[model samples]
Target: MKYNKTYIFGITLVATLGGLLFGYDTAVISGAEKSIEAYLIRPLGLNSLIHGATVSSALIGCVAGGMLSGLFSNRFGRKKTLLISAILFFLSALGSGFPETLFFTKGEPSIGLLLAFNLYRIIGGVGVGLASAVSPMYISEISPAGIRGRLVSFNQFAIIFGMLVVYFVNWSIAYGQTIEWINDIGWRYMFASEAIPAALFGILLFMVPETPRYLVLSNRDEKARTVLTRINADRLRAESILFEIKQSIGRVTERSSIYSYGKVVIFIGILLSVFQQFVGINVALYYAPRIFESMGAAKDASMLQTIIMGFVNVIFTVVAILTVDKWGRKPLLITGSIGMAIGMFAISWLAYNEIIGISTLVFIIIYTASFMMSWGPICWVLISEIFPNKIRGQAVAIAVTAQWAANYLISSTYPAMMEYSGALTYGFYGLMALLSALFVWKMVPETKGKSLEEIERLWKK
Candidate 1:
């Protein structure tokens, strides 16, 4: 079958925009942390609990969004649902950025005001959640089987790119500013910057066609044929592709227990999702600045270091994209898990002994690099590819919801945990990393270059 490079690249870009939004939303909060703590906790007199809740509000939305994306995408078409997610992203950015002004902030501790801000963050979180589940799914469905892993990996690449961009934006905004100036206005600008990408995402959504699987599922055969033709570039192959989708849909519907698959698949998917988070990658990404601060760097220096971490993340994600097909998924997971465990153990020892110098930074960079090349991008690629078409949407949704919930738990608890046991936290994550390696060794199969049908057959057998 002849491949249309232009169509593939265009669709990949649209789907990957969700990654951009994900990266922007996730990392944008880092810059706002100091200002948010100052205004709400220090000056406004809110306690640590409330301040922490406020900070992690977006994650709550992420869980809810991920939980619902499967249902929404199944009911609406993927393209429409993505457009709806874009709307949510735009609103969340605006609401989160100017919460006090958008809603009614009477003075200091207004319950309504707090809830309002959190609600906005949740709205954006939902967008992230939907994108997380669907973007790769969309990419997977549309891509040629031979190149599916590499193309779907573009989603993770976009996410890391987004993270890197925001880090640079954050650093530039706070570059020469004093603590007072940063606390006063700089953070708000950081949150507001999300609006640019959010708008871009919305515009791009219109330019892409709906997934052919989705159109076929909805019985819009002509539209599905058209999409398949444009995407696949051969009438005969397009019809065959459409027929395959129909067969999958028919098999799924014939089962009286389609919903039960969600239960079993969701359990596995959620565990994989949760384990990924519990491994504590975000603790490194989200709190890099604070972690550097703990290592005796000034705020500006710490922010600069966080940017460096982002750069490392981007570079290694490229490495993963190149090698994921060549090396296969299982080996990457095993290698990453081992590397992460070792890196974490070393960092824990450094922090535990108060080895305050360049060595500590070097180790953290190694840890981040290890993650980007393996679990960071490859996990999403595997999840996107491994599930059967019958339960792919629902299963992936469950996994993503579990991931966000785990992310919230890890992010929210980290501060207090650090206060109580700094080195112990790293030790705990290192242990999890070792366990992750064992899990992969025992359960994960190599899915490189296999079609979805082939993967499903191998798993069922």
Candidate 2:
């Protein structure tokens, strides 16, 4: 099939805005964590438990959003579901930024206030979950089979780009602020920064066409044909795509059951999602500032380093986009898992031996780089490709929801773990990385050049 570079790029960019919001919403909290805890939790006399809840409230929304994506995307179409997600992101940003005004009393922090703030965060979290599940699915469905791996990877690139932008924004805002200033006012601005990108996402989302698969499912044959023609620029190829979509939708409608595949595929999908989070990628992305602080760095220095990590994440994700199709998904996952394991082990050793210096930071950069080039993007690619078309949306939703839950678990527990075990916590992450390598080797099938139909057949075999 001939590809229309302009159409592909345009649609990919719009769909990838979902990734941008995903990154912005998830990582923005890192910048605000210290400040929020200091000003709101400490001054309000909240305990650590409530503090943790405040931090993880968005994650709860993520799981809910992920689970709902299947239903919404299946029912309302991918484009509309994404529109709803954008709305949620906008509201969450506004609500989270001014929770005191929205739901809390002035100059007071209580469980009630914290709950309200978390509720807002959860709304955004739901957006993240929906975006995470739907963005790549949208990209995968629209992308040409030959270039699908690379195009789908653009979603990850956007995510890292979003993370990088937020880190810079956070650093710039907090650059010269004293702890008092940051604790009092800086965090509010940090969260409010998301409103800019969220608005951009909403506007851009309206510009993209609905997925052809969605169009065909709704019996909008002429619209589907038009979209396919624009994407492939060939009448024959466009009709072929429409035919495939029809077959897939027919199978799904005929089954009329979400659990048509029984247990094994669901288990694999859920495990893939769970492992992606269990490896603690977000612990690094979400808490890099705090981790650096624990290594004896100042707040400003930590924020700067976090920005650097975000930069590295973006660069490596781009590299993954360039190389995923050529290198194949399994190889990248294997290499990433091994590299992460080694990096994590090295960081653990450095911290455990009281080597609180540049070496520890260097190891972290290596870890983040390895992950970005491998599991960070590759996992999403695999998830979008591995499931059959008939059940892909539902299966991917389950996996993504599991991922957010795992992410919440890691992020919520890290503070306590650091307080207790410090380096040992990293050692545990290292071990999980190693196990991830084993899992990839044993279970993950390479789907580099195959079409989605071909991959589904291979998996069924």
Count of residue pairs whose backbone atoms collide, per candidate: 0, 0
Give the clashing pairs for model 1. Answer: none
Runs of candidate 2 exceeding 4 Å displacement: none
List the candidates' TM-scores in order: 0.95, 0.97
Q: Per-model C-alpha lDDT, please?
A: 0.82, 0.86
- Measured with C-alpha atoms, the lDDT of residue 107 in candidate 1 is 32
Clashes of 2: 0
Error of 1 at 350 (Å): 0.9
Candidate 1 structure quality by residue, lDDT tens digits, 1-461: 48898989899998899988998898887777867787656666677667667778889989998989889888996887788888888888888777777655643535666677788888899999999888988988888887887888889999999999999888989988888778767877788888888898999898899888778777898998999898888999888888877876777676635353345444555666776888789888777787898899988889988988888888998999898888888898888888888888998898889888888889888788888898888888877877777777777787898899999998888888888787899988889888888877877677888767677666456
Local lDDT at 458 for model 2 = 70
Q: After superposition, how far is residue 233 of candidate 2 from its true place, in Å?
A: 0.4
